[model samples]
Target: MKKRVITIICFVLIGIVQSNAQVTFQPGVKGGVVFSRLTNFDSDFMTGFYLGGQLAIKFNKLYTLQPELVYSQQGANSNYSDLLIDNYYNESIITVNNSVKHSLDYLCLGAISKFSFGTGFHVIVGPSLDFKVNDNFDKSYFYSDSPIGFDFAIVGGFGFSFPNGLSLDARFKQGVVDIYGNNYNTNIDNNNNGNYDEVVLNQSFQLGLSYSFDIK
Candidate 1:
């Protein structure tokens, strides 16, 4: 599967490079701290890290399209009791400990449109395809079945770049897809309000430092 994906990426990059020879390509590497959690579900944020590389296809000074491949670690810490998981019986109460953690690792493929401001500041917005590489969750927890292996998310961020190729950026990623495959969706009150919405969506904030190398 990785080989197939790499082949497709190579073909796409070649096509893109051949479309315009005058465009500059800069390769960059990044490492970041990630604060992530599942939306609602009485979950708390967990800290992780992400590392990746990207290629900046610069069309001009103001516009550039960046494609990146990153490996990110993220998840949430769930500490709630008396979860009514009526999967087998009419009323089943499962007491989850405070230390139950959902650890997830994802391989993220993304492309963003970067717009530069007055000097070195830039804003980027894009979409990402995240594939779950690993997950550690109890099978008989609040989720009835296994979580989905893929997620679609939108990325929004801002960064400042220096002439020496150093940059600092922050990004917020929100998952649009509900990865929770639970059959019982209307039972729990995650937000402690009167409404009940047990939708499971991944949300994260990332702060990163990067350095780019000019390709000649």
Candidate 2:
């Protein structure tokens, strides 16, 4: 299903490019810092980074479409206490303080629309499809479960470009789907009603700089 969707998007974009005789293309590279956290995880945002490349297709002076491929790092850091049984004497109960850091990496494909207001300013809005490339948990005390393989997010931002083609943007991305698998089970009962936790979502803010140049 994901492959089909990607293929369809590609064909549509190709058709648009072919139909527009005066379309201009610009290719660029971008890198940035990401502040990310998991919602409902009782965690704090973790500082990470992203690097990516993009192709911007301009149909006219005021409207543009940009498709980007990015490698993004996102996750959270959490500290909590839990009850544990000693390995040596299985009956003895112990209160353990645990700190865990989860680092999730994704390869994201984003399709963004830019509505230019003035010479160098634009409003950007887009949808991104993300595939998990890696998931890492740095702790021995807590068990780390992998998140769902795919995620969907909505992104919105404001950007500015210099006359020299140096561009900068700040964006917010909010996950619309659960990052955790449906079978995921959590020991923490956040509601205090003796039920396992619900799904968790990803929330992030990104600040990036890019250099753009005309391709054709």
Candidate 3:
């Protein structure tokens, strides 16, 4: 998967360089803090950040499509009582109490549709695909491991641009796909040696700053 992504990026870059459009294409960096949560598990936000570049293609005076590749961090943390496993019928109370920390990181690819409001301001909305790079379950009350999964999200944001080719953007993104991997027995090893890991699909919100260059 990583190799394929690299190949695609290389091809895109080559094509851009070879194009003969009168429009300008400027690529710049983006980075900002993110707050995320896992549904059905925890409700607290995890602090994360992202840094990436965008390839913007200008179309006339009103709109453009920007494709971005960013390394983003997204996840959540829950208190021991949040799982509500402390009842006799609830098994895994011990495990839930033991799970102290958990997190997920993703490599994301997204496309943003820009509607220029003129005077260097634009509204952006689009879709993103997230590939989990790592998921961690840490703490004593639970198992000593974590699971892997993928995420799908929709993005919307606003920004301001400078006539000199610099821009500032702020966006909010939400996950529309279940982050959960699957369903299985809540019991760890059939014999109930431990508790089965629960996967939660959650929503993420981000406030980001990005710089864009114009190519014409």
Q: Summing lDDT over every window of 10 consecutive residues in candidate 1, give the lowest-scoring window.
A: 187-196
Q: lDDT scores for all predictions?
A: 0.85, 0.86, 0.73
Tens-place lDDT per residue, model 3, 92-137, is 5443343244677888999889899767898999999888887775
User: Residue by residue across 115-209, what tens digits does model 1's lDDT show?
Assistant: 98868999999999999998877543564456789898999999999999898999999987777644344454566453335667889999999
Clashes of each: 0, 0, 10
TM-scores, all candidates, are 0.75, 0.75, 0.68
Quote the lDDT for 177 in model 2.
72
Error of 2 at 197 (Å): 7.9
Task: Judge candidate 2 against the unseen true structure and give its global Cα lDDT, from 0 to 1.
Answer: 0.86
Ranking of all candidate structures by their lDDT, best first: 2, 1, 3
Per the 3 Å backbone cut-off, how many clashing residue pairs does candidate 3 have?
10
After superposing candidate 2 on the true structure, give the runs of residues whose Cα lies further than 4 Å from its correct spot. Answer: 1-19, 81-98, 137-140, 183-197
In terms of lDDT, model 3 sits at 0.73
Name the regions of candidate 1 deviating beyond 4 angstroms. 1-22, 81-97, 139-144, 181-196
